[model samples]
Target chain A: MTRIACRQLAPRIGDLPFNRELSAAAIRDAAGADVIVLPELVTSGYMFASPAEAAAVAVRPDHPLFAEWAAAAGDAVVIGGFCERGDDGLLYNSAAVVDRGGVRAVYRKTHLWDAEKSVFTPGDRPPPVVRTSAGPIGVLICYDLEFPEMTRLLALGGAHLIAAPVNWPLVERPPGERPPETVIAMAAARVNRTFIACCDRAGTERGQEWTLGTAIISPDGQVLAEAGEGAQATADVDLLLARSKALNSRNDVLADRRPDLYSPLLHRRAPS
Target chain B: MTRIACRQLAPRIGDLPFNRELSAAAIRDAAGADVIVLPELVTSGYMFASPAEAAAVAVRPDHPLFAEWAAAAGDAVVIGGFCERGDDGLLYNSAAVVDRGGVRAVYRKTHLWDAEKSVFTPGDRPPPVVRTSAGPIGVLICYDLEFPEMTRLLALGGAHLIAAPVNWPLVERPPGERPPETVIAMAAARVNRTFIACCDRAGTERGQEWTLGTAIISPDGQVLAEAGEGAQATADVDLLLARSKALNSRNDVLADRRPDLYSPLLHRRAPS
Candidate 1:
């Protein structure tokens, strides 16, 4: 069993010190969790005014603030998104996986969302799967999860659990309903037969309202646990269940793919 | 405004003549509809005992039955799945789009399900967008809908509405809830911002139970119309709504795709 905790936080733009303290506090509260996930841009917040501003707020994995959070996490694994300063000196929307030892993996956001295209450079590579106490956990940032290709690749790479850190802006939907972001996560989890943990930020930023919650979905596509709007969510799940990608006695989702016919999917040209 | 009708049928194996009559009657019933969709393998029931059994039930596009159905269809466009005997002498699980002008498009099943892999030849090409009076209609069959690549391609090809003819086998899910198939359809529709009409067949065939119903989802991922278990469902919706893929002032789903990072999707190797 993997005890997972999701922190839905509302970080202020450019408030690095305050966001770091908030994340550290969340980690301290989740003392017994095997893994704790925080939302995208949780360290500096989204909606940057300029590329230079975004770059200015980006941090290195070895930054002292990350070390403080890692210490607070103790033995538990922590996954959270931050503005990143890559070795190439470009700013990236990246998520890092941390443990008591140090930073284990850092994944740059491959699919940038609206306005982010102008602010941060899109990561060229897909996120890497890191071995964990429960199983291999794949990390992805906001908007990256919208592309099925991203999650499918992680699942194909043998990820037992996908940890998504999101700052989801509310889209128009029927009144009294879960946001489309949550619905998309549920579908992706079912199709890939992989356990998914989504941590979305709460509160509005620059007139953009967020979903303000966390949703943990099982391989069967059912919500195992969810936070009522603006609440922190936690759940313990058997990660072993996700290792089996079989839908029935004879059908396995990943094995059933027809790669030969999927060539167009890879070489997709921008919508004409 | 486009009037869409979905025929939820229970076809018998090898009963081509009877199935033809049933389909024609449904077309007659949907006379006022702009487009009507039928279930996968509607002409010949699914669950073939052998390749020979499937081949025996397969028909050609120029088959007399199709012509009669087209004539009965009159002015309205019809889309339905059928077993096909390709020119290469291979059997395929295919869907034909027929109108007053005759057969407009034929799409063979690209992603064959369970026993279908052994009996049917997978389609070589992707589904096409056939221009219609209502809008561009994209057709995909059964298992093909499970792959996001298939739907994304059609959406990129400028399809306003995706007509999916499915024969959905009931899968385990939370009780008294919409099946994962419906959820996936809704998610796909929302993500692509495309209107989707899924017509599913009812009843058991050779001991295989099915989710008997039909669901039409709008671009916002809300159900426009749905039939109760084992009923023919119909609804009229504005296909023009799907033409606007923009979620807000700044975001458009199709235009936001990061084609550069999706290369891994194209060079997929079958899962080990």
Candidate 2:
């Protein structure tokens, strides 16, 4: 694979036409890539201006807006976040892993963070590691990356690449350093020894400022290609190489796990 | 108080005399600051270069080095890692929180990483959060910072500052980013919302590459002051401010943990 584009899509909040148009343009530019990743809730910037608006903009998996970029997604795995309405009418933060073959697998946000728990329900089941045309891919929504065990679960189950879409807030600190969110992603990459295509949203939305630490990190947690403070960045990864590294096992953390000690906490039973 | 001197000491792999000299020199430079911290393994690098060399370096609580430093330690509270031979002859990776008053508490690292298990035993009990003139302090060794729950335990127990002494190796990835050891330390600062001062060793001894990412991290996880890629560095902390941030709970991660949902995992039976 030659390139993957991490689109730091910062569409205007609540502006459907503008967001659709802007996302289309980004898709055109990323057409040259093997994979293109976008930030969480990029289809709708952070989802809602208010609870009332959330219900209005929420769409199901078959939303017409996604149809616009389907053709451009040919030969590429285009991954992005959106608000999906479940059969029960509850809204879920979900990622669509689509190829020209159509939407591949949908991963709902598992382990919601902070204010999200108030709005979105926790996912009932774990995401399956789907075999895509490119490789066996795993997708995680923003907060899903925080739990070490979650990523470990995906990796041990045979996931080679983890695609993440996030909306990081503006934190005034180091220029290139990401607010804890990016660090967690990098940690996941190293521990799993898998490629992480993490795209973060950029620009200020009305009043709330968002930080974009769009980057493609290597299996060793190296940020190979990083977007600027707020820019769309692109990268390329070799899946075969990553698999070889994992199989051969060099100085890899995932290879050296003391599973006997970890099994207790991982398999621990909750009190009744 | 200003001008805290953080000593990034690489104690003798298994030599006690060499370890004492390194600690004594760093103590001499501990001038105006109200606190001082040194890297773990100040008395003897817990990892044995050879199993045969282990017994020769491990010290006891009554060792003269402890008394000498206790009596002469500057007006500041000085803390660093050492090796203590328990009655069972098992070596413990211990840190002494020493002040001019006396040796306050000796913390044995409760969590050990990787190869550490073969050389040293885990602490028998939990680390104590001791009250000091500078602030409420807690001590942890190199690998202890990796466990988020352990650090949270320290914070919940009313620790305002965590002093960790580490020996981290330089890594090739993340480009200019600090080694993974510092990343974990910084994450501890962010998650716990406390000031974390990490003293790490410097220099490439023989062929081994030691990464020096010594620094003071603020409650918000910002590096207040950092020692470039070498031995020693120092940073003055506004202890009261860090304590207030942690106490009042400015960052919501610490404040709003969904212990109810997570509590299940607490009582969960260990993995088989």
Candidate 2 lDDT, A160-198, residue by residue in tens:
778888887666777766667677677667655778888
**lDDT tens string, model 1, B1-272?**
88998988888888888888888888888888889898998899998899999888889999987887788887788999999999899999999999888899999988778778789988988888899777799998877777777777888888889999999997777765578888888888988889899999877889998876479988888878887554667777888888787866667777766666655653554322
lDDT per residue as tens, model 2, B1-272: 44456777666576688778778667766666667788787777655665456667888777778766766576778888877788888888888988877778988887666556667777866667788888788787776666554555666666778888877666664456767766666666765577888888765554666777788887777777777543456776676655543322222444444343343333322211
DockQ scores for all the models shown? Answer: 0.50, 0.13
TM-score between model 2 and native? 0.80
Instruction: State the fnat of candidate 2 relative to the true structure.
Output: 0.02
Judged by DockQ, which candidate is best?
Answer: 1
For candidate 1, give the docking quality class from DockQ. medium
Query: What are the per-candidate TM-scores when only chain A is compared?
Result: 0.95, 0.89
Give the least accurate 10-residue stretch of model 1 chain A, judged by summed lDDT: A263-272
lDDT of each: 0.83, 0.69
Candidate topping TM-score: 1
